[model samples]
Target chain A: MGKIALKRTSLYASGASPVNLLQARFYNEDCLVYDLEDSVPVQEKDAARLLVYNLVKYQRPVGKYVIIRVNGIYSEYIDEDLEAAVRACPDAIRIPKVEHAYEVQKIAKRISEIEKAAGIEEGSIELWCNIESYLGVLNAREIAESDPRVVALALGAEDFTASMKAARTKASLEIFYARNAILMACRAAGVEAIDAVFSDINDVEGLKEDVKLTRNLGFDGKTVVHPRQVDVVNAAFTPSKKEINYALRVLAAVEEGKRQHKGAVTLGGDMIDKPMELRAQTTLAQARAAGINV
Target chain B: MALNIKQTAVAGTMESSDVMVTVKPAEGQGLVIHLQSNVLTTFGDQIRATVQEVFSDFGIRDAEVFLVDKGAIDCVIRARVQAAICRASGEGFNWKGEDK
Candidate 1:
């Protein structure tokens, strides 16, 4: 299958929790992250790995992109996590606390080895690096372009704020630079950029505002901790009806101009240039991904 | 394929669509299973068959398996059983050999 272009929301389900893992696929999010990192306690790591492996292999969720968030690269459990996760054949393996390009390369190399040993196609599994520290933000560009398997870079705001010794707020002013830095890196590398999770699950209004900011800042998606946040983020990322209509009209105008052999395509008395055409195409693509007819 | 059951271990929970499985070294008991499920009367034979299949796949001849089911399906039952057996055996799973 082809890659998913519009991943509006990636929902995190604790790997150790059977109920959550079973129900994760039914949610409206574009991606499902079976997390074995911070969400699983140290004692349950082994059990969680086994559970996630079975769930991914036998009862693999359909219609949604599945990713397994392994432990940190330097941790003792990383090798085992990769061994199980790679064999499980999730769409991607999320590496936490990535600060350099070499880390991604090394992990990708190990993933290749596992794939070969398991008889799975090499490079079939992808990677998602989590940038949670100041150094990670600084080296974001190199990390995003580090390896071909690296498909996305996600900002880990809770840890990033802690690393900077700054407080996390609803306004998210503290990690503004990190967010933009990751976004810029992803854009430059032609990969997707996923925003951090909105920690406060109860504040629906706050989550809506945060999602709006996430979309306005040009993020491809957001990581949601709670199931309730999925629809809000998905809705915010999906193209609105009015925007879809304008994109359709812009494409039609371009086609008409091509048929007439005109120098420039004008939509509603305004010239539609390259950037506008590209934006219109992207809007329609996103609409299509969200299941809109147009 | 030989796993030594060194300790008693438990996996899973009593939540809806989940089953809590506990495995213990039964020495000479030869694969005994005590199961309690809300849907026991409806799915009793199928659940037992699933548990027996997991133990047979693991090459276990003797063990005490206790399961509390809350309407878990076949896959969930298999996962929880494997988790409990692995934990009790104090060994990492051989994914290639046992996962099929």
Candidate 2:
């Protein structure tokens, strides 16, 4: 298949725990990310890597997007991590701490070598670059446009906030600029952008509010850590009932305008042109993909 | 290849339903197992049997396995032991999640 569909909920589970792995695979998260970065302890990295490799190679996560979060590009474990990652044939490889375009290029090179050696197709595995550092946020556009294998850009809010020496608040005003910049870069590159995880998992209301912010920010999806958070994510990514109705009306108006041989149309006293029609079409498509009854 | 312990290696954690398996070279003629588990009273023999089964599968004849179990299941115990033995045998790229 082409690059895996952008899932609304990307769940990050600990690679060291098989129970967590099973949960993530069976859960509602459309994307399952086996995290070998921060979740695994230093000494347990090998164990986690082995388990993740086995899960990717031996077992099939049917109806799920399987991704691996390897160590940071500059970390010591990336080489070994990618060795298993490429051979395992996961849908994607998520690289953390991506500050420059060269990082993605280097990973793409390594993946190319592994694909040849493993007899897998080159560029089969997609790359998701996580922007966490100040430089990463600054060079988000370059990183997004770095390589074709780099299909998605992730906002690593905790690390970004720490790097900026800014505090996270209920409103999250500190990292607003970074989020907007990353999303803008992804838009320019024609790639998907994922929102960061809501660390306060118990606060369902907070998660709902956070997801609304992400949706308004034009994020393709949200990254969640807990299984319970998937529902909120899926709901947030879906176009609401009101949006679907408006989109349908807009499309009908566009169709009428087309039949009348008129390029310009009006809907609800507002000018409806090609751009608005395209936006409406996209909204309806998203709602359909989300299984909404629109 | 026969499984031979080259160094001391440990795998697993102290979390609930987890096990920490440590392996070292055995000076004796065969494998020796020391297990600590919450269900030891009823399942001690079964757990030891499972460890021995894994050892036999790997063709390990001389090694000391120290199993610290926190109610881990059979598959997890097997994986932990497999990881520990792989590390102990100085297996390259195995611990890094590579095939062979």
Tell me, by DockQ, which candidate is best: 1
CA deviation > 4 Å runs, candidate 1: A252-271, B98-100
Q: lDDT of each prediction vs. the true structure? A: 0.91, 0.85
Question: Considering every candidate listed, which one attains the maximal lDDT?
Answer: 1
Off by over 4 Å in 2: A1-3, B1-3, B14-19, B27-61, B64-79, B95-100
What tens digits encode model 1's per-residue C-alpha lDDT throughout B1-100?
7686678999888888889999999898798999999889999999999999988888898999999999888888888898899899987777667323
User: Global CA lDDT of candidate 1, please?
Assistant: 0.91
lDDT of candidate 2 over B9-91, digit per residue (tens):
98888877678999999866598899998899999999999899878877788998898898876766766787788788877
Clashing pairs in 1: none
TM-score of chain B of 1: 0.94
Cα error, candidate 1, residue B3 (Å): 1.1
| Residue A79 in model 2: lDDT | 89
Clashing pairs in model 2, backbone N/Cα/C closer than 3 A: none
Writing each residue's lDDT as its tens digit, candidate 2 over A1-294 gives 444564799999898887787567777888899999999988878778866776677675887888999998878899889987888898999999899999899999999998887778888999999999889999999999999998899999999999999897768888899999999999999999998888998999999999999998789998998999998889888888889999999999988998999978898899997778888988988887777777
